[model samples]
Target: MSDHPFDVLAARALRVGAYLVRADDQGRLYDGIGLKPEHWRRAQTLLADAPEPWQKLLTSDPGDDRIILPNGGHILRLSSNRRGRHEHTILAVIEPCVCSKPLGQVLSESTEADSGCTNVTTPGQCNGCAAACLSDPITVECLLRCWYEDLFKLGRQESELTKLSQQLAETYEELNLLYRLGQELTVSGDPRCFVQSLCQDLLEVMSFRWVAVKLFDLPELSEQLAGMFVCEGTTQKTINEAEQAVEALAQMPQVHKPAVVLDIASQWGHLLPALGNSLLAYPLYKGETMYGLIVAIDKDPEAGDISSVDLKLVGSTASQLRIFLDNVTLYDQMHLMFLGTLEALTAAVDAKDRYTCGHSQRVALLSRQLAEALGLPPDRVERIHIAGLMHDVGKIGVPESVLCKAGKLTKEEYEIIKGHPEIGANIVKDIPHFDDIIPGVLYHHERYDGKGYPHGLAGEDIPMMGRLLALADSFDAMSSTRTYRAALPRERVLEEIQACAGSQFDPDLTPHFLSLDFSEYDGQVANHKAGDPGAQGVAA
Candidate 1:
C-alpha cells in the first residue's frame, strides 16, 4: 500500500538486514525484514553501550549520506514522518540475517548477547552459512544510485497523483453545476430570473470576480425582460458598467465562438473601466439571429486565470439559454396557430345572429376572468377561455327566424332553441383537442334546480367546467341586449344574479363571478356596437 521501491532496493543492494528506526529514539525499531524482536532490543543496547562514536551514528540523521554501525550495519535517510521526525532505514548485521535458518533459531543459539555482549559489534557463527555478509559500499555505488533514482520516481508519482486528484475534484464540481443548470432549464419560465440564477451559481463554482448576462432582441421572452441585465459577484462597477461590458461583448464582430480575452487592459482597453483584468464571453445565437450574451469577467485570483474548462462551461450555458428562447418562440407560434382556427369557426357562428356580433369573444374573455377568479390552474383556465369562444356554435343550426323573431317564441320554436347546447357539444366533439370542453358546452344550459335544459344535471352532478361556464354565459346573456329584452343595468343584473343564485346558478361560484370587473366587458360591448350598428339589440 505504501510507495517504497527505494527502501527495497536500498536493502538488497547493500545485502544487509534493513530495519526502520526513529532517529530521535534509536532504541525503537520498525521494519526489520528477517530480524527477531529480541534481536532488535539487544542490538539497540549494544549500540548504547558502545563508544560515543557508535551512539552518534544512530542519533544523527543519515540524510542521503550512508552511515556505518557496529556489525557491518548501514543506514540511509528516508523522508520525515507526519510527526516531523526522520525515519532512519538501517541495513544492519544481525544473527538471523547471516544465515538461511529461521530468525527464532538464530536468536536462541546466540551466546554472547544481553548478559556479556556489551559492545556494539555482535556477529555469530552460522550452522549453515557464513558468519558475516558485510556490504561493499564502493563496489555497489552504481546500484545505490539506483536507490536514489527510485526515490526520485516516487516523488514524481506523488506529484502526478496530487494533480490527478485536483482534476477529478474539478470534474465533479462541473458535473454538479451542470446538473443544477439542467433543473433550471426544464422548469424555469422567467428568463430574467433564470439568467440571474445562472450568474450567481457560476460565480460560486467558477470563482469568477464578476458574472453577468445581457438579453436583447428576444421577443418571445416576456416584456419583463426588456432592458434586463442579470449579474452576480462584486466588482467596483455598477450595473450600468456591467451592462456596458456586455454591450462591448455583443458589439465585438469577431466573437462568434466562445473565447477568452486575457490582459483586458491591453487587449480590450476600451472596456477596461467596466470590466476586470480578463474576460470570458459566450454569445447566445440561433442561426443568424443573435439573442444575448453571457460573460464572466476576471476569475478569482485564487482560482487562477480563466481556463478552457471555464470557456466550455460558458458555451454550454449559452446554448441552454438559446434553447429556452427557441422553445418559447415555437410555443408562442403554436399557441397563435391554435387560436387562429377557432377564431374562424366562431366568426361563422356569429354571422347567423347579427345582433351578437362579438358575443363569442366577449363570453370567452369573461369566462377567462371567472376561471382566474375561481383559482383554476392555468391549463384549465386557458381551455375554458377557448371553449367560451365556441360555446354558442350550435346556434348556427337554429333557424334565423326563431333566433331573431324579436317576438315571443312558440312552443316548437323554443324547443329548437333548447337543442342548441346538444348541437354545440356535437360540433366541438369532432374538433381535435376540443374533447375536454364538450361537458362545458353541453351542460352550460343545465340549471342548479334540475329544471332548465337538455340534460337537467343538477348541482354537483354537473362537470366542473360546466358549472364554471354557466355563470359566465348567463351573466353575459342577461347583461347584454337580446332581441326579446333590453340590456339590463349593472345594478339590476347584479341583483337578479344574486336572487337566482340557489336555483339558476351554482351558489358557491356566484360570489367570485359577481366580483369580476365589468369595465373590460363594457368596453368590448361598445367596440362591437361600433363595428355593427344594430349589434346591441340583436339576439346573442
Candidate 2:
C-alpha cells in the first residue's frame, strides 16, 4: 500500500476506537491520535514491549505484521512506500479484537457523522460495530473530517474580525476627542482660561482625579512659576497633593528635561495619597523655551494601563497648547510695537501745526473715555482711541503753509483741508493690521445730518467709531486755542456741542460726551503746553 492509502486507513481506524502511530527510521514514534500526554506514553510503551515485531517490520519483507500484547491489545504494522522509498511504517492498535464491520458504519453510529448511514445489516449489533460495517468507510471518514476542519477554521476567522472592528471604533473616538480639544483651545485668548478649558475638555475622554497647568514667568530654568490653573474631580486635598508632587518634581535637577511618567507614591512617598500611583507629567515647550507643564494625576483604575493611544493624545494636546501660548506672546509684543508706531506717526502730523501740537493725543484720550462710557467693549474702545489719534494723519499731504495759516483762508484753502480725511485713510490703509481703524480715519469729518465733508454719511449711516471720533475731534479743536481763534470757554464749547448735536454730532452720543467733566482734563492740557515751545503763549 502507498503512504496516502495507509494514512486514510489509519484515520478510519481512529474513528473505530483505534489509534495510529508512525515510526520513522530513527525509532521516533508520532501518535496519529490527538496525542494527549497519556496517549503518547501508551504509544511509547507499546512500541517498547513489541521490539521483535517492530524490528522485523523494519528489516524484513514489506507486508502487514501484527503483535498481540500482554493486555490483549493488538498492534498491526503495515509497510508503505513513501516517495518511491519503502522506509516508512504505520502501526494501528485495536483493543481486544478488530471490528468486522466497515469503519464508516462504526463512526456514523458512534460519532456525529455529516451524512447518515443507510446500511441495515446485523440486528442487535453495537453502534460502533454497526457503523464500522458501512459500505464506503474511507469516503465517509474523508467527508466528516473536511466538515470539521472547515467549521473550526471559520470560527477562528470570525474571532479575528471582531477584534479589528473594536480597534477601529476606538481609533475614531480618539480622533473626535482631539478635534474638540483643538477647537476649544484656539477660541480662547486668555492663557489661564485656555488651560482651565484644556483640563475640562480632557476629562471628557481621559479619566483622572485631577488636572493642572503651571506656567513659568520666563522660559528659563531659574525663573519662578507665574501661575497655576487647575480642574479637579476629587477633593481639594487631592488637588493639593497633586500640586505638591508636581512642585517637588519641578524643583528637581531634571526639571528642564523631557516628559516623564512616574509612580506618585514611589516618587513622592505619600505626597499624594488620594491619587493613584500612576501620574503623567508632560512638559509644554516651544523650541528651547519651556512654557509650562501639564500634569494628570491618579489615572482611573477602570481604564486599565495607560495605552499608547493615551500617550499620543496627551502629547498632541500639549503641542497645541504650546502653539497657542507662543501666538499670544507674539501678539502682545506686536501690539506694543504697533502702539509706538502710531504715536510716532501722529507726532509728525502734530508738528505740522504747532498750535495743535497735542490736539490729536487729547482727542484720543477723550474718545477712549467716551467710548467706554457708551458701554462699548474694551477692544472697540481701543480701536476708537487709535482712530482718533490718526484722524488728522491725512493733513501730512497738505501744505504746511495752509495747515499753519494764522487767519481764515480762501474757499480753495478750506477745500484743501477738507480732503485730509481721505488722504489720511489712504496712508494707513496699506499698513498691515490697520483694517479696524480705517473707517474712523476716513469718515471722522462726516456730519450727523449729511452736511459734513468727504462723504455725507449721515446719522446712523456713519460708522459708530467715526461718529464718536467726530465729537472728540470737534470738542478738542474748540476747547484748545487754534491759529484762527482763541480757546473757547468751557461753557461756550459745551453750548456749541449741545446746539449742534443733531446737525454736527451724532444725536445719541452728544449727550454722553456732554456728560463728561472738562475740569479733570484742565491739568492735562496745561501739561501739554508746558512741554511744547510752540504753545508758549497759547490761551488754555
lDDT of each: 0.68, 0.67
- Identify the runs in model 1 with alpha carbons over 4 angstroms from their true place: 1-212, 217-280, 295-305, 396-401, 429-435, 526-534, 537-540
Kindly list the per-residue Cα lDDT of model 2 for residues 415-507, writing each as its tens digit. Answer: 999999999989989988888898889999999999998988898999998899999889888887787888887788889999999999989
Candidate 1: tens digits of C-alpha lDDT, residues 207-310? 88888888774664545444578888886678887787778768776566677887777877765568878888887776776667788888878878889888
Name the TM-score of candidate 2: 0.62
Candidate 2 regions with alpha-carbon error over 4 angstroms: 1-174, 182-197, 219-278, 305-308, 335-339, 358-369, 372-382, 426-436, 449-451, 478-481, 485-503, 510-540
Lowest-lDDT window of 10 residues in candidate 1?
Answer: 111-120
lDDT over C-alpha atoms for residue 110 of model 2: 40
Which residue pairs collide in model 1, if any?
Answer: 355-538
State in Å the error of residue 339, model 1: 1.6
How does residue 129 of candidate 2 score in lDDT?
Answer: 41
TM-score of each: 0.63, 0.62
